[model samples]
Target: MDFVEQERMAHGIPSQGKITITVDEYSSNPTQAFTHYNINQSRFQPPHVHMVDPIPYDTPKPAGHTRFVCVSDTHSRTDGIQMPYGDILLHTGDFTELGLPTEVKKFNDWLGTLPYEYKIVIAGNHELTFDKDFIAELVKQDYYRFPSVSKLKPEDFDNVQSLLTNCIYVQDSEVTVKGFQIYGTPWCTIESIPSRCITALYDNCSAQDRKKLRRVVNTAQRITQTNLPSIDSVYTSRCLRQAANIIEDPSHPGHSLFSPLPSGRKSLCLKARTTTLKDSFYPAVIRLLNGPCIH
Candidate 1:
């Protein structure tokens, strides 16, 4: 409702020492659902993409075609949502309410039910618990802003990343699934989130981890998720442009940065080494698209 509330919820700050799941918003009409980003679908010319009905569950896909389902910013409110079938499930970020262990377990339980062969996930800005360094820094460093945040104990959130047992949790790392080099990271540019107070990933990463961080753009056969803060439409395109300018590269075709709202496709590109798509980070229904990959 208010900017303070939005900021608070975005950071998973508890209202009264307890975090609650926010309702996920979905775009009723399909087109506007893609808020604004730099990824152009025309470049790859996907074989086909069926968004509205999702071709029904367990439907057949063409041979050599791999369907990828991308979703983000669910915020731990996936109770009634209907899921589509795909070979790989790429959840960009924000799957939990507060990145709490209980919330992570709930999200993990849902992941367990999914029939997808591979499920890859990365944390979003909302994953306050998973970004334990951010929490420690907040409690120790920031002076004026984190009055409530300073109250959070680092021990409660330590090893929070471990709760994600059901899916491949990748932060500044890569996992090769079915020959596709899928890398996931929560690294946000200072330009992307200018208001950011804590340097989460940059401060936490080791010297070696920083090396992998630099390689993010160059190493993606398919880099699945990026959580960019939602700006109004007038600024969305510009913000996305700023992000793409840094992430996109003409030399390496495999590097693409995709995130929900902030994020799919069929036949996507049989040989499309690098592809980018933007889905509205808020809505879940319209956010569901087939990420077409091959086996």
Candidate 2:
């Protein structure tokens, strides 16, 4: 296949048309039963060239199409708001205010009642209980200095998973539906200030927390390389530094960005968010356009 054909296939474009050919087999004896031959390619003419027009930058999605409704940072207020109808319902993270079992159960119960055909859920920084290692590290780091809340035991992870029966729970994982690939992660970059005050969702000032964050980022990169060659989109909780690194890296495959929900409980659509991702050597700022949003 030529490079153009490969690119076309990558973008799910169809060929202009196809041609059929026939073949005849020769035998030693004229009276012998004729052998059948099947030819899959045409030999007479050149292949047709199909050209797909590029979509305009400002084109609005058509109405009544396959819509994906996205809501995030609900903070355990699932029953208080009205949800739009969509083919897929995606809850980015922070469904629970305190990452407690009761909070998780309430979110799950509300998720089960949604009318969307597909539902995807991911954890947020508040969902510390969902990630055991994260919670353990926080405890070791004297997490009590910040605030005291219901701490989840190790076994509670299984119980939380069981409660989220109606939705697909994704933590550094991918799923496919109707040939569209969607990747989800619950990581967000940690912002640290002097005096050990860490913000930006997940805290990673501790060595163990850093290692776990790296593992999640590495897993995302590996999945992108192995399973996302033909992925249509990605759904992540927040744009962690690791995710931003993957997006800004030119060596990686191209991907679309989906903006994070606004800080409050406003029904805002996805828009591009710009951020600076710094490493040991290079520091760069890039703009990522939020992924597709249909509503």
Candidate 3:
């Protein structure tokens, strides 16, 4: 069997590939539990809400919180620096080279060992496993495409979850950790050449619609349909007590909520209490096949 055929059999997914959705099952306490399906936001709508929600006010703040480490673009390169320690670890995307089972397993294995109360992972352009359906289809026809990828399978979803016991995978969803309200999304506009998954914008539309397509594509310039938020939109600590209506739980560790940071501010320091624990996060990093970051 060729590489494609061998790979097809190995994962039990079709040669054309498949799409997998992972819902995080969270339980703050035993009785109250919910499964979050927000990570797959771009593909599906929220069960009820039609519009994206404003970052909820009265967002909780878990007491005795600490540091948060944000990293991105590992590209199967987790061996370099010793990961920084924080209370929460946040990864943006590009978790794998081809989203192959082995690669995913390897990355997950590393992620699992990290010690943190909470870990958040969002998909990135390099995650080939996110589009398995396309790969399976190609293989069935015996026309193999290299570097083009596949999505996760139902069977493998558990594997992903198992690897990150403390992780909350957010596609287009939010999670409350310690006291922070974290929203995760694995989306960027960079195109993957052989991978139809990344070039999705052009896949369905026609050349005549290129202009329209450009707007829809996951380019860095326009990462999402909704524009990025502004810093003032978030409730930072300059007015914490008064902003209780804006923060969820202001006392928890790593209690972060996402809104836009100011134009020049690197990060917003929300008041309440500083979370000092050292946590490390791996964000999604795009791997270019031939060109610059795609739009």
- Best model per TM-score: 1
Candidate 1: residue 237 Cα off by (Å): 14
Please report, as a residue range, the 10-residue window in candidate 1 with the lowest summed lDDT: 279-288
lDDT of 1: 0.58
Q: Please tell me which model should have the higher TM-score, number 1 or number 2.
A: 1
Give the lDDT of residue 215 in candidate 2.
61
The candidate maximizing lDDT is: 1
What does candidate 2's lDDT look like per residue over 1-295, in tens digits? 3334445445567644433333323332211111111122233222343444655433543442455677899998766687765678888888987677778888888988888789988887778777776666665565664354435455655446567888999888999754457788876422111111212322223556555555654564464342221110111212233455665675755223322346532223433243222211111112222233334
TM-score of each: 0.47, 0.44, 0.40
- What tens-digit string does per-residue lDDT give for candidate 3 at 125-208? 666446445445533454345433323344543344344444678867899876668887654322223122222222233456
Error of model 2, residue 113, in angstroms: 1.1
List lDDT for all candidates, in order.
Answer: 0.58, 0.53, 0.47
Candidate 1 lDDT, 169-236, residue by residue in tens: 99989998876788888965423442232122233345675565445433431343443333233233
**How far in Å is the alpha carbon of 248 misplaced in model 2?**
31
Which pairs clash in the backbone of model 2?
257-290, 257-291, 258-290, 258-291
